[model samples]
Target: MSDHRWSPRSPVAALARFVGVPFDAQTYRNLAYLLLAFPLGIAYFTVVTTGLSTGLGLLVTFAGVPIVLATLVVTLGISSFERRLADHLLDVEVDGDDGGIELAFGSVEEAIGTTKRVLTAPAAWTGLLLVGLKFVYGVVAFTALVTAFAVSATLLAAPALYDAPGVTYTFGPYVVDTLGEAVAGGGLGVLLVLVSLHVTNGVARFGGFLTDALLGGAARSAEAADA
Candidate 1:
């Protein structure tokens, strides 16, 4: 297994190291999980949003606020699903930190009470907010991912076919009247693809940071309790 552990005496350096990249096996696994998990999150958001929006719209009794509430409920389910997915995919040992979940309060009554406490807690709301943000982001990311791939591929390919001396036939909404234009457009497209890669990578890293913040429940709780 690869060791991703880094030595940083200070909090700031430690955070910088964590955010930059994983050098150890664990870090690599976590990063891979994060990358893969996002697409899963996108799919999860799409299915949930589509299904809930359609289903709730069908119900006449469900008004605007009710629909919002229903959506929130679905979002919660998605959050739980993603958490489990992350755990399984990353092989993250949440038990050590007791951050993922805690089964401290035993018995049905105690469990219910503890749940109520968690629900009412500010950290829980922050987690929900994080989920909401991720849902919106996932939807956008999925759209951009498809669009970028399509646009980049088409543009990069256009130079080959359209710029070819023998090939005159052009395609799509783009008007490549001349071979020069086609070749130029392809160059522009290649630049666009580089830009898209940067954007996607930025979004992925930002999403990972947000996930770390919102999903670090034990850390949040401990801090909150300390304060």
Candidate 2:
């Protein structure tokens, strides 16, 4: 109880938070980040993977060094964008902090030097891996969030539609043909929606961790700034 990491401030408070769901600011912010993750994931996967493969292929001919460097530079830039996204949306620090992410290469010479550093950096590779994984998780998360919301909306509206002729909704082989059943379904919908908020929070935490581990902590913040 004393340690928030080990347990919630209070069991009751945790339950209340679960019930309150995504109505609050943090949850909404998490939801927004989740929605954006899919597209960003797609972009990350496409660019990084392409750059890696292209650079690797050209390596044999000595033509690949530049491509590899370019890829690293691009990924580094993308990582910076991801850091900004996490800092802005997720509950984390990315730039202008003790351990933050700030990658800005201004000159050709600077880019060349930065690229060399980025290639050998484990954080850069790890960050690329995280970016690739984000696409997969983002798809699943987006679907779940949308499904939860849709179900909640439909069930909440059931009672209003119950009086309509030939109106009936089925839930797991249970037909909601009466006002009472409709209302009950609506209540269930509410519960599911609340649960989904926690899911959104979990996903946001993951994104934040990835940003912190890979894109953050100022690898070249000072150098890039001076560049």
Q: Which candidate is the best by lDDT?
A: 2
Global CA lDDT computed for model 2 = 0.73
lDDT of 2 at 120: 58
Worst 10-residue lDDT window for candidate 2 reads 95-104
Candidate 2 stretches with Cα past 4 Å from truth are 1-15, 94-115, 216-227
RMSD in angstroms, all models? 9.7, 5.9
In model 2, state the lDDT of residue 122: 48
- Encode model 1's per-residue lDDT on 1-227: one tens digit a residue: 73355336666767665444423454444444445655665665566567557756766764544344445445455555545554664443221132344434568787565555445444444545665576676667667777886887877777667756666535466567676887777887877766665566566556655655565664566667879
Task: Report the lDDT tens digits of candidate 2 across residue range 1-227.
Answer: 37654366678777767776756898888888999988888888888889889989989998888777777667666766677778788868764332233344798777666666666554566566776778887788778888888878887777778668776666656777887888887787778777777877987898787677655544445447569
| Model 2: colliding residue pairs | 100-217
lDDT of each: 0.57, 0.73
